[model samples]
Target: MITFPKDFLWGAATSAPQTEGAALLDGKSPSTWDKWFEMEPELFFDGVGPNDTSNVYVQYKEDIALMKKMSMNSYRTSIAWTRLLPDGKTLNPKAVAFYRDYFEEMIKQGIEPIINLFHFDMPWWLMEKGGWEARESVDHFAFYAKTAFEQFGDIVKKWATFNEPLVHIECGYMGDAHYPKVHDFKRAIQVGYHTLLAHAAAVKAYKESSQNDGEIGIILNLSPVYAKSEEPADQEARHKADLIYIRSFVDTVVHGYFPQEFIDLLEENQLLPETQAGDRTIFEENTVDFLGVNYYQPLRVQAVENPRFPAQSPGDFARYYDWPEKRINPHRGWEIYPEGMYDIAMRLKKDYYNIPWYVSENGMGVEGEEQFLDAQGVIQDDYRIAFLEDHLAMLAKAMQEGSQCFGYHMWTFVDCWSWLNAYKNRYGFYRLNREQNYARSDKASSYWMKQVIEQSGFEYGGHL
Candidate 1:
């Protein structure tokens, strides 16, 4: 049996806009998502919008009970900025009361809550005022962060300022798949720099707050970069992609400064983000106490000969090279390489001073999970079980070699609504029965996970 540490955290994760159904209720204004979905209903999957979520805002109590049933000791979720402070200036009393009580219930049930302040759901007004592109959005986000700390910091000790800010930067600004779609690389870099600036400000706010007894960090989807070949250009491609995608955020958050090489590259390309005088001090003074790494796949690339996409974007830095032998999650079209986990841990151990971290998200999202349901009505998700086993075993090996990973959170607890994908792909311990008003039901993986958590380990090679 590969056992984990006694105090290891085991749970799942969720975000607000993806799960909370009451998009515009109780003084909650519309987010960019709400506005965008209204503008282009056809863009979403199966005609589902943010308003048709899993109803976690109303079903959180029952969801907490479901977590307890799954033997989860912790859960990572985000506070909807639109819900808590719709206008981004004033706090809603009802929202504040609901969050306090919600967090209290989770804590009371022995499930520690790692509450994140933002999860890509920008307020509609803020987006109207230029979102992360404008310099002023940084200050607005800082104020919002301070407000969150003032309101809920006492109960929510493990605070993450943003979840996967990189995705926000790349997808939203680069004309990819998010809101305010624009293919402006200059604005993208500005967004990236300002987002980090806002992160530093949030960290500073957390440190200055009275309830400063806990850690403040950022969750980044850090994918390991691999060279497609031994050629010098391919190796350069790997380094460039790594710097742009992984190190650009990890180094700033952990090492407390923007990478000089990346800065130089941007400057040489005339893509450097405009910076203020005192911004350097905020970043240098308030580095993170820990980090949340979200791993889904690794980057395999070669030198940019022919870019993958026509637009000039980050993907152009190192064009993806298809590897014949790479295994892929056919449902999601993402490569499946469990070795990336070990690589991530070792890199953190060897380079980042072995700072505290956790696998904030690692799970498989299979299309049509209900097709796996057996005669007993329990979804037999053996594919998901194998995915977890492979990743966890790799993480265990990394731990034996001295990786400072504290927990492992699956991508989601309930098959919550994905942003544009809606409920097309399911990644949950408990399947969300959409046809029956999002009723929850245990899956075969849930039963298997309970045994793993109860035993603190599992015999993986044998059948359960």
Candidate 2:
């Protein structure tokens, strides 16, 4: 029987906009997501936008009972910026009370609460005023962080400043996939840099707060990049891809500064972000106490003859992006390589002082086309179980190799609305029926995860 250490944390993760339903209640203003769903509903897949997803804002009591049923000892959830502080400047007492009560309930049920400050839910007011690209938004974010620390820090000790800041840069700024869609490489770099500065300012604010043992950090979705071949061009392509995609955020957050290679690349392309004089010192001195690593899939890179520039470019010889040929899961259309987890852990250990870290979010998403009718009308999700098993085995191997990895939390607890995909790719142990007032039913993976949590490890051929 494979066993994990007794102190290992077993939990599930959920974000506010994805799960919570009360988007316009209790003086809570609309966030960018709420505004996007209202203005451009057609942009979302399946014609479903974040109206009242899973109704977790109201059904959190029942959700906590579900967590208890799953034998979960830990849970990760993000604070809705607009929910806590409308207009990103003023705090809502009712919102603070609701979260405090919810957290108290979780503690009463013997579950540890891991609170993340921002999960891509920027307030509409802030977005209207230029979002992260503007310096005022950074100051507003620092104010929100300070307010959160003062109000919720008494009970919530584990604080995460931002969740997957690189995703915001890549998808929202560089690519047009996410909301506030802008396709400018320079703006993406500037937004990414400003995000790090905000994170550092928040960390510094948390350090100065009255909470003595409060731990603060940032969450990064660290996907290890691999070259397709041993050719010089392929290797160089991989390096460039890593610098742009992964190292830009990782090096800055962990080492408190951007890599010189990345700066040189930005300079060569004339895509360098605007930076103030004291910004470097803010990042360097205010590094996080821990890191939350979200591993989903590895990026496979190959040398490209001509890289497509999302922004206006001045070069003809600039290389483009290409993916390495790899096996992808039929259900999710993502590469299923478990060794990427090991590579990520090892890279963190070798390069980032081996700081205390945890697998904040990792899971599989499957389009459940064939819905099975179990006794309670549950869908059997054996594919998700298999995905978690493979990845967790890699995590166990990394732990054995002396990586300072702490715990693992799946991507979500219940199937909720994804940003643009809506509910197309379901990544949850429990399934939610959006039509029936967001009714929830536990899938087979829910029971499987319960057993895994109870045993603290996986055993082959043991009733999954």
Model 2: residues >4 Å from true position, as ranges? 307-325, 461-464
lDDT of model 1, residue 64:
96
In terms of TM-score, the best-performing candidate is: 1
Cα error of candidate 2 at position 353, Å: 1.7
Which runs in model 1 stand beyond 4 Å of their true positions? 306-311, 462-464
What's model 2's lDDT at 225? 79
lDDT of 2 by residue, 222-265 (tens): 88878778999888877887887788788887888889998888
lDDT to native, each model: 0.90, 0.83
Clashing pairs in model 1, backbone N/Cα/C closer than 3 A: none
* TM-score of structure candidate 1: 0.98
Q: What TM-score would each prediction reach against the true structure?
A: 0.98, 0.95
Residue 372 of model 1 has an lDDT of 90
